[model samples]
Target: MSSGSIFRFSVMAAMLLAWPALADTHTPEEVPQTFAEGFIQGVGVPVISVYHLAAMIGIGILVGIAARGVVPVLAFGAAAMLGVAYQLSPYDLPADDAFVALTTMIIGLLILLRKPISPRVASGIFAVAGLVHGYSLGAVVANAGAVPVLAYVTGLLIVQTAIGVAACAITLGATKWPARRTVLLLAGGLVIVAGGLAAIEAAGLIG
Candidate 1:
């Protein structure tokens, strides 16, 4: 790899390692933060939030394998909107980061197995994953008010959809190249590693 690429990966690894080694307790609180800052943070979280990012990447890879990015993305978005509504309502669901970790691991394993599941089943799986992920995201912006929270969610949706679509495209491209299966399996392996670490972190056993 190029030096610049190595450096960037190193930075990302460092950031991921620095994610809280315990259950997430961050709640959105009103402050001097601006709308632009909120939007930026929303976009950045999928990249910087270690456990979440790990799960997202794993799920994205699985989506790529399934070659159905749109279903999961839309399902996730709808569930996320519902999650936000739950957050804004009287109902409460304690979102432990462990769920995210576990979900990611599941998705990674599925990719590794390379089993053929129906599209509807796959969508259902992704939707459940979305619920877990969305609830956590909703919690993060719980106190940011309706409009700002909506804006943040919008940013999240855009970034997340992009990531999913990109992963799918890359996987499709790899499948057309020589040693396609090998490349796909290798990608799956990487997702597993990332998910495994995130799982450990979520368990508070390591960071």
Candidate 2:
């Protein structure tokens, strides 16, 4: 598709994704009690939340652009897992909408900048971003049992890895065509919008 077409499609997709998310809503209660429960929750939770979904998708795309290979994906996953650990530990940092909103915005900026970063640099960026995103995700299972938490982490890694890989592939493929690269830039702009709105909502600015 042409860049314009891709941009238009991305705009529509963003609107569809964002419209429902505009409302102030809470995620339904689904504590991970059993391994099954944890696995289900882990697989489902990231996409269900708006900022989380954006962050994960943005991460995938950025990784695809900034670095080549699966190592960056693994770095993101591992760092995210570590973030979860920190959240569940005494070193717990903030895990609020505001925090995630910031992380998402950072991803947006990185994508929008369009600067060439080395693989090492990209890996570092992905690690830090993943940690922030993971910390936020850890809130859902902060108190789960060991077995369930294990299952939950496994599920999360699997789902995120899948997403990262898919997004990376699509991004790499699309960018190969000079006319299609703008689509990713426009998509990055959407990520910024999403993050900005999330921050606004978090601050009770749009009520």
Across residues 36-92, which tens digit of lDDT does each residue of candidate 2 receive?
988887887776766666667777777767656767777888888997887789775
lDDT of 1 at 36: 73
Model number with the top lDDT: 2
Model 2 regions more than 4 Å off = 1-28, 204-207
- Give a tens-digit lDDT track for model 1, residues 106-125: 77678778765556887788
Whole-model Cα lDDT per candidate?
Answer: 0.61, 0.72
Candidate 1 local distance difference test against the native: 0.61
Q: What is the lDDT of residue 110 in candidate 1?
A: 83
Worst 10 residues of 2 by lDDT: 19-28
Model 2 alpha-carbon miss at residue 64, Å? 2.3
